[model samples]
Target chain A: MTDRTPGTRSSSGYSAWRLIAEELRAEIGDGRLRAGDRLPTEAALAERFSVNRHTARQATATLAEDGLVESRRGSGTYVTGEAMRLHRIGVRTRLTKSLGEKASASGNLRVLNSAVEDAPTDIARRLALDGGKAVRIETTRSAGGQQISMSTHWFDVSRLPDIATVLRRTGSVTSALRESGVDDYVRTSTVVGARHATASEVAVLDLGQGAIVLVTEGLDSLTDGTPLQHVVTRFAAQRVRLDIEHPRAD
Target chain B: MTDRTPGTRSSSGYSAWRLIAEELRAEIGDGRLRAGDRLPTEAALAERFSVNRHTARQATATLAEDGLVESRRGSGTYVTGEAMRLHRIGVRTRLTKSLGEKASASGNLRVLNSAVEDAPTDIARRLALDGGKAVRIETTRSAGGQQISMSTHWFDVSRLPDIATVLRRTGSVTSALRESGVDDYVRTSTVVGARHATASEVAVLDLGQGAIVLVTEGLDSLTDGTPLQHVVTRFAAQRVRLDIEHPRAD
Candidate 1:
């Protein structure tokens, strides 16, 4: 009554279920499991692997833990990566447009605070400014009514004295910068990471306990690589999938 | 002695701590507070924000929860994002190099199993195979002697019967593909997300409870976007940072 896949060791190294997870993970990696594609039913996997359905569920659960797949309520497990609303990271990516259907518009952005503050050493360095005070703006953003991101921005007050007023009115950082005689800027670099939501973040983002948020600290620069802005953002990991694209090397 | 930051709301909307977090987060965003940089001491921030040390600690803790800042043992809080160890995402990125010190060579790879398996419909489609059998390979990888990633790979048996042997011998997937007549390939796109670690993953990754991992499901192509490989990789988010870069427009 001991059913197992033929021609594989069962008791030596990894268990039967882990072996299955390995294969499934490979499939996901190799593009067999595209984002948003539903995995086989537990029964189907169990029968195929000659194991019980419980073992099959274990395999999918591991994928869920890694954010590779997710189990929807009453539905089956779906490949999670790249399936959620896509947030494109690129030179000219617009904040709202990149979120696609998940985000409403810049109009929905909330300007929570604006003040003049000491430009910390690093901040002053990136902005090409000397040690001085700068304009700081704090904002929270949402997607489809769910709070998704929170950000803080700093600008050299002497360069953009009206930046706070423009940011409050437009709710768009790009527009605000443009009005200050900076015609255009592009994202120069982005470093991405993830961590658990803070207690305060949970209250704002409405996350369940142990929820993770994707953090990005990025720099924007003018065409010739003059740094203009440095921003850090926390995105609710469940609502967004980040697509990091690299251009062809000529 | 109710000292507060002058000209800001206190008893109206958010509490003082939340507003402090908001301000600090903005600093992080705008490059005032940079990744890897130590924040002001609790006493210093308390004086700066005009709040008590308890309130200041609460603000920093919120940043920590969001993975923006981290408190080290006796080392104070440091920004957690961009500084954790940069994992550069680019067309020519090498796995070991991208990880910096976090990964060793492909020599650390261990092949767990190899067998022939039916190509699931989706897997078949991405691999450009019909409904037929394919070779499956499973492997677990480590960094600095710590288990970091596990992967499964599939190849059309007819196209490369010796793939498993080649991968095992060279310990490099690119070399294996190279031996099979694929001269070169590039990462076409990548989808990045994060989630909690599973029980099995926790044991393998040696992570504390509620730890998060960065999952990337990416596609590699033969310079023409002709899909060559699809892979999902899980990285301990604490050990690595991913830099998603955008190339300049000529």
Candidate 2:
């Protein structure tokens, strides 16, 4: 073990603890320390870094404050798993996934089922579609060979002249609707809920029984109050966590 | 087959759809339907409720809007599961049982470990304690027969006189701290992260290997800038979903 003596202040006059924290952070960034990996105890860490126990503890505390590690009772501090990127739900500009990047991530789409069906009565009213004129697009998406999410989107057929042809070729309802000359749409509202997965959902998402699924239904409307899309998406509960950050109005 | 006759209402009215939605909502509240139970399809439900396919669809949509059920495309609608109650991270509300019955839902504290060792260099500075004058209380808590979480709370030994006697009798760090004449404390900051469960955490919380754990560290300070308590809590990820709501100030 190295001597447990506080290091001399460097040329920059930085404290021993700050320097140690910076080194450990660099190691984590370089993929040396990974999620669930435990660092040495205070004594061992002090010896390893050639610092007193107090200085070593200070470095670790700094890491904890920055959300890099978690210290449990009786359990040594371990690296955090995945960090979630939080975004405000209502902001539209931040929603884009960079079309080029998203295309490269996964270009394959599974057309689960589609039909020229009448809008469900409630959807008809919400979309203001004629009594029996709506087209539905149901699709499932996968990423990295794992099922990511499933969505069913509804659009008024009257609004799209060639809805079927567009859906068949593009495989994206958003793109299909946009191609149909509809623009300037706003997501009016979204309702969220959680539920146990059905047998088919479990099979499609490869989830175990009793695993919860979060569902979000979003309604988009044109500038003239014409409903453009009523889309519902179901996400695998275990693999994803939804964060809705509301913007603060100053 | 249910008739496809279009209802004569051009605008809004107490449509047949609203009546059916009320019945389904009542069934859920009365426990006839439960989380994870599947509902019959539009065809079957229309036949049973004596309504058109459109009306049946409308009823289901209303439930979906209310966050009561989730409808997966090509599959079916199922009851939404109830997850954990959302709590703002820095909000200092007294933790209480779900049922509102304190005695039955109260948590039991198990003092896993305790020590009066020298403060780790970092902790000493944070707590403003001398190297040899800090006490750490490591505790695990169980609620409703389940190990809900574990916490490590540190205190300055000088401020807390006869800590062992108070801890042994009160069985609560918050209560003991209050009894020792400390007041006007506020949570200064909190750090949160997620990770896979450790072997001991899995055993204690009865969690699976892949289950996620949500860890939060909270620091509290008195009005005079004296550190009051430092607590770290780990919550079972599957059983709880963290919800944080902040008012948007535009």
**Highest lDDT, which number?**
1
- TM-scores, one per candidate: 0.69, 0.41
Which digits, one per residue and each the tens of the lDDT, describe model 2 over residues A99-155?
223333325445666677787677888888868588787777654454556778787
Task: List the global CA lDDT of all models.
Answer: 0.71, 0.59
Compute the DockQ of candidate 2.
Answer: 0.03
Residue pairs with backbone atoms closer than 3 Å in model 1 (clashes): A26-B152, A29-B230, A29-B231, A29-B232, A30-B230, A152-B26, A231-B29, A232-B29
DockQ scores for all predicted structures: 0.25, 0.03
Worst 10 residues of 1 chain A by lDDT: A1-10
Tell me the tens digit of each residue's lDDT in model 1 across A1-250.
1123522333212345655665675466545678889999999998888778888887687667556688988998898764356678888768888776646667767888989888767778888887767888888887665676888787778888989899889888877888889988888888888875654565677654334678888888888888777787888776666888678745
**Reproduced native contacts, each prediction:** 0.53, 0.01
Question: Judged by lDDT against the true structure, how good is candidate 2?
Answer: 0.59
Q: What lDDT tens digits, residue by residue, belong to model 2 across residues B1-250?
A: 1122223231212245654554565456323587888988989878776667887898798677555689987879998864233333323424443312322423476777788767656667778786547778877766544555677777888887566567656776656667788644656555444444444565677653223456655677775566777676666644443333332222
- Complex DockQ, candidate 1: 0.25
